[model samples]
Target: MSDATSRKVKRFSESDRNSEFDAATQKALEEIDVCQNEIDSINEKSSEEILKIEQKYNRLRKPFYEKRNNLISNIPNFWITAIMNHPDLSALLDETEEDCLHHLTKLEVEEFDDIKSGYWIKFYFEENPYFENSVITKEYHLDSATPTSESTQIIWKEGCSLAQNVEANKPGKKRRHEPAKTFFSWFNDNVDPYTDDIAEIIKDDLWLNPLQYYLVPDVEGDGENGVDAEEVSSSEDDEEREGGEEESRNQRK
Candidate 1:
């Protein structure tokens, strides 16, 4: 036998129950793998527990969500004002999206650091009968193009699947605002008709399902959701200046 084999055989102790019938190195490695499997099993159990907790949490929040939905139905321009309050999102939107915003029950945003993989936005609905598909998801691939603003931004990493799809299927000689052959464009044109030919069938369907209401809206509106840092700073500065002026006036009086 080889010297290595001789060493393994010498290391294996028949008297030691831990060694069993295997070599010392083999026994140690096998036990480590067994511990790792236990760890993995416990991790899976934790994941299951988290999912159960989330389901219960949703069930508890459903009543409040429905109550808010009812209030929104009664109060005109409720959602409109909410959307306009956010400076960044307001810039991207116009008056044309009023009707579409009404039926938009829920929007979920999942951000990924891997720019190549990009971000996923899932729109959930209560009763959208016009479209056969209930769920509409859009994936925006990160691009390395120059940002319009001078501030540092997380520009998308290019050459991913999202970019490739857009490049491969771009419409020939399209105008600046003209719709391209992207999945988002298709969703906007086919499902979300902002023009005169609006589909009431989907709206009526959504009206009956009270459980589809959402408490919090998505921050990312078509990828531009957050207000600029400068705007926030300016607002704070104005508030501070007003407070200081009021204090000085009170002292003089």
Candidate 2:
């Protein structure tokens, strides 16, 4: 037998119980707990400092975000395109919802005055046949590290309810246990705030850096031509600006 396998291991009987450690070992364990408490205290302070830092940057980013929204508004269907490009958000969208999202003009995320309190996700839409409301907002409020959310009720047009169109658990269907909720249904369902994947994905991923997703299709098409992604994205911005200027010039003419 190999030395590793041949080695005899000590096996203690179940009755071999010691409720107490030797004095030195017990003292050392107490000291270790004290050290861990100190470490935890440092971590708590660091978290507060980090939140202050985020609040500072968030204020600085506001004007740039506003300018970005203005610029993107010149690019038709910009919000819908970006939302569609996101893998997580795209999976939730069906063709019916995609049609509705085409009218989405702007998307905004705003943190509460107290950065730790929570944030809001706002979707602005042009006057569309799908819904009468001009905007829909979902706010996630954090209370003692627990999250809760509420959203604006959609005043959907007559006979144009996207949520009602979702088909689930039908016999003879290819996917019998398909998800009943469409992307539109997200506005209403808040059963488990912790498991609200759509809100989490949107707030964490898409809201942080939407420009990357906005240029996804352009980057894919330009990859074979040896064109840089940044260059393509820059060109897209330039084109949108020029298009806006041309529209203005035409109005004057």
State the lDDT of candidate 1 residue by residue for 165-232, as single tens digits.
33332334232343333322333332212320111212232223322332335544433257665677
220 Cα displacement, candidate 2 (Å): 9.6
Which residue segments of model 2 deviate by more than 4 Å? 1-19, 165-180, 218-253
Candidate number achieving the greatest lDDT relative to the actual structure: 2
Residues 1-253, candidate 2, lDDT per residue (tens digit)?
Answer: 2232222111111212452666566556555655666676789899999988998999999999899899989999887888889977888778988999999999988989778887888999999988888999978877666567777878878998776532332223353223336676666654445667778778888877888888886435555488877788899999999999999999999
Q: Give the TM-score of candidate 2.
A: 0.71
Residue 84 CA displacement from its true place in model 2, Å: 1.5
Candidate 2, after superposition: displacement of residue 201 in Å? 1.9
TM-scores, all models, native as reference: 0.34, 0.71
